[model samples]
Target: MTNTQLIFKKRPIGVPDANTWSIEKNPIPEPKEGEVLIQQHYVSLDPAMRGWMNEGKSYIEPIKIDDVMRAGSIGKVIKANNHPKYKVGDCLTGWGGVQQYVATTAENWYKVDDTLAPMPMYLGTLGMPGMTAYFGILEVGKIKSGDTVLISGAAGAVGSVVGQIAKLKGCTVVGIAGGKDKCDYMINELGFDDAIDYKSENVMLALRTKCPKGIDVFFDNVGGDILDAALVHLRMHARVVICGAISQYNATTRVKGPSNYLSLLVNRATMQGMVVLDYAKDYGNAAAEMGKWLAEGKLKSKEDVYEGIENFQSTYNRLFTGEKNGKLVLKVL
Candidate 1:
């Protein structure tokens, strides 16, 4: 059998295009001892993938040219060679990259119960994005009841969950999204108290109107202008969780910093960047609590799934173009 893979061809300057990745097929190899072969069913498409493409000193290593594109994936183990923890038919999720099949050791790979949620959901709420929201809001943002929580990219994966968790904790949640539809989704579907349609509204004015009491916690995913606007609306002792900066991910120029950061000093607020990997030790406990909330209907999860590995480039473009909703997932098998 042949394994289809997307190879990293070039480091993108701005938005990645067709030239960024080259599709190739390679022979499926037999697993070595202590290794397992996974047939990936779905791979996660996240905004962070853009950062991984760049040569930089960051959280993770840059994807080298000619290597398979790195991604979080969920798959079933089809073959195991003396693997102690995993066996054939076991469903696993980890850094399986963008491939039809992967052979790897057990380290860093997690076994997820597909029965609890679909495989794609594992790549969404029950996985990295969910973990990001859980820790970013609770630990980094230090949110409390009665706080006004504002989230940029509020309709996307991590932001959506952050808003819901804030609501469940008795905070008034306001979401900022690009379009009317996404804004509506945050309010009507995700139970956000209010939403700002950044595409049509004056974001600064809208922030002033929606967050009349000032924001006590800001969970930022889309940075750039929206981040500056949110910073200007901070209440005393507010906490800003820098979960992502999707707005500047594809920029050819240097990424912009919040221009109105003086508001942080004036309000005595704190802004900190959070990396989910820092909270790795507590993932099981967090996922358990999030799972309970999901079961009780206190939380919601959404995944926007697209088909085919060949369609990867176009599907990934949706992250920046605001074309897809919620957590973006690619069905590989």
Candidate 2:
């Protein structure tokens, strides 16, 4: 059998294009001692993948040229080489990269029951994006009941979860998304109190109108102007969770900083960046609680899945184009 892989080729100055990656088919190899070969089913397509393509000192090392593109994946163990924690037929999820088959040790990969949720859902709400929202809002944002929570990119994966969790905690939630459809999804489907259609509305004026009391917590995913607008509406002692800056991910120039940052000093608010890996130890407990909420219908999980490994480049474009709703997943099997 052949293992198809997406290889990172040239780094781009702005948005990645067809030249950024190349696909190759190589012979599937056997697993060495203490390793297992996984037949990957789905790979996660996230905004963070954009950052991973750049050469810089960030949360994690950048992907090297000629290497298989890095991504979170869910798959079944088809062959095991004396691995203690995992066996053949076990479903596992981890950084399996962009490949049809992966041979690796059972270090970071975690066994998951596909019965609890679909494999794609695990890559969405039950996985990294879910974990990000859980920690970024609760731990970093320090949200409390009665607080007004504002989220940018509020219709996307992490932001959508942030809005729902804030609502469940008794906070009034406002979401900022690009189009009318996404805005409506947040208000009608996700139970957000209000949503700003950034594509058509003046975000600053809209924030003033929707958040009349000012915002107590801001969970930011799309940074840039929307972040500056949210900063201007901070109430006293407000907390800003900087989970991501999707707006500037593909920019050619330096990332735009919030010009209304002085609002932080004036309102005595705090802005902090959050990395989900920091809360790794508590993932099991958080996932259990979230799973329970999912079972009870208090939380919702959405995944926009596309098929075929060869379609990766086109599918990945949806992340920046805002073409897909909710968490984006790619089916490689």
Identify the runs in model 2 with alpha carbons over 4 angstroms from their true place.
none
What Cα-based lDDT does every candidate model obtain? 0.93, 0.94
Q: What TM-score does candidate 1 reach?
A: 0.99
lDDT of 1 by residue, 1-333 (tens): 799999999998898988999999999878899999999999999999999999979998999999999999999999999999999999999999999999999699889899988999889899999999999999998888999999998899899999999999999999999999998898899999999999999999998899999999999998999999999889999999888999999888888988999998899989999899998889899989999999999899989999999999999999988899789999998
For candidate 1, the C-alpha RMSD (Å) to the true structure equals 0.8
Which residue pairs collide in model 1, if any?
Answer: none
Question: Which stretches of candidate 1 lie above 4 Å from their native place?
Answer: none
Clashes in each model (backbone N, CA, C under 3 Å)? 0, 0
What TM-score does each of the candidates earn?
A: 0.99, 0.99
